[model samples]
Target: MCREPYPGRVTAPVFVLTPETVEPAGAAATAVAGDRLVLTGPEAHHAVAVRRLHPGERVDLVDGAGLRLVCEVTETAADGGRRERLAVRVVERVEEPQAGLQLVLVQALAKGGRDEQAVETATEVGADLVVPWMADRCVSVWRGVKAARGRQRWGAAAREAAKQARRARIPEVAELLTTAELAGWVRRVNDAGGLVLVLHEEATVPIGGVALPDTASSEAIDHPADEPRGGGKGPQDPVTIAVVVGPEGGISAAEVGALEQAGARTVRLGPHVLRTASAGPVALAVLAQRVGLWG
Candidate 1:
């Protein structure tokens, strides 16, 4: 729903204003036409110094939680490096509902930043969330403080990719998990009536041939509106589709067996095998097409 709908158009040079940035509870929710909003800190610096945005320019601001503000800049000032201010008058405010299908990427650790690249492209291809998995055959491992740093890097990548894609909502990066823990995750998703696909080269079924969840029918089931998504038992939540991508050495037989037992369907992309970095994105592209997300 939108106030003063623009009808089939949005401005460029988008900036994110997450809920954490807003002060005084409910301020953002109450914003209306002609209301002035200020932008400071790193985002303002990018708007003022890097982008050289001038007064009278149009830019879009998103809360990454489905709220988009079509605004016109009225002021821009830079004090120093990473210190600046940008102000805009809100023209229209829109509340976008979540998509019916949620795409999640479960990527295994790999050497040489391949895993990071995988997530970046997947985010660009419309993945809703990313999960880091320490597969049994992984060459790279995250331990101690390194694990936190790795997760932060992946989160940063997803944010940048979202910006490049002009996506209103940025994909979330989940906590790292081991193979055993991933099996439990698969079970939870399956128990909640979601689909989990494990990409394997030897699989008989291709990703295109695999049956996707019927979002139309899923939406018909009665459940509480406030119920959470993914692992929830509620049928009202959007159907989650998680794609599991293994490391360079591929998933071990034991790991595959465990995931299969947990209710994951193993599928292949095509005749040729893709690298760990490219497999997830390729599969996601196919799924996005099959599920009508691309349309």
Candidate 2:
């Protein structure tokens, strides 16, 4: 039987295991209680040296793909070596279910680390996927090596935020998208019956008032089913909800027109204008509640 942990009483620090590390354990490895497991490498070093987690302490090991192992530390390296390892026994293995609605945040790259802040907050607020957008008025241009580095930074930020939030799944940071490419993506998602909302200060529709689609509908079209997200007993086709946030200079009218032409709905959050870093997270929180993700 699976041992249920106390609700709202999380006592252990979370350490994420990469897919490569967790996948080799196979599906049956952590299925039963009292299963022996070892946590090694950088994660273990951080747990022992940085966190000072001693034996008898509890910890949560997540694959960032729905698999979470609740473990009790049985032993720790006594030599205090830099490359230490931690051994634990699994108390329980839980496969977290996917959210009712898959939230996607398409944030335009901005200067002053504002884009990084946006993605970090969005991940903590339950955004399932994040896409970095190169807007027309973006002051921070990413080209060549800079683009790859920027995406890596964003992914790192999201991973840290997910760990802080104790999330079983980490949000994916997609490749950078130009305005035209973003429009194409919007069309593809729309064709799959997904909803895309572009945040505009001048829009007439309030984001809170938009009717959320029923994710339980079996007739819903599948959008990006190959996403690394795992853990569903049966097949489920959840509708994707994408929120677009502009850069520090704001979105250009031409870009807005292109997004609208591609079947995205322009919506306003409130009366006051928000900074680029705050807009997407706010919209995601509002939509998450409306779609029962908060429930």
Q: Estimate each model's TM-score.
A: 0.90, 0.88
Query: What lDDT score belongs to each candidate, Candidate 1 first?
Result: 0.82, 0.80
Deviation (Å) of 41 in candidate 1: 1.1
lDDT tens digits by residue: candidate 1, 142-257 = 99999999999999899888877767777888889998899998999898788999999999998889888776543223333244546555545768898999999999999999
Which TM-score value belongs to model 1? 0.90
Residue 214 deviation, candidate 2, in Å? 2.0
Global Cα lDDT for candidate 1: 0.82
Model 1 backbone overlap count:
0
Provide the lowest-lDDT 10-residue window in model 2. Answer: 1-10
Compose the digit string of candidate 2's lDDT tens values, residues 1-295.
Answer: 1111236635578888764443235532445577877777778888888888888898999877666888899887746666677788888887765554578999999999999999999998989889999999999999999999999999999999988888877898888999999998888777767889999999999998876666654232333436542112234545679899999888899999999999899999999999999999999989877766665
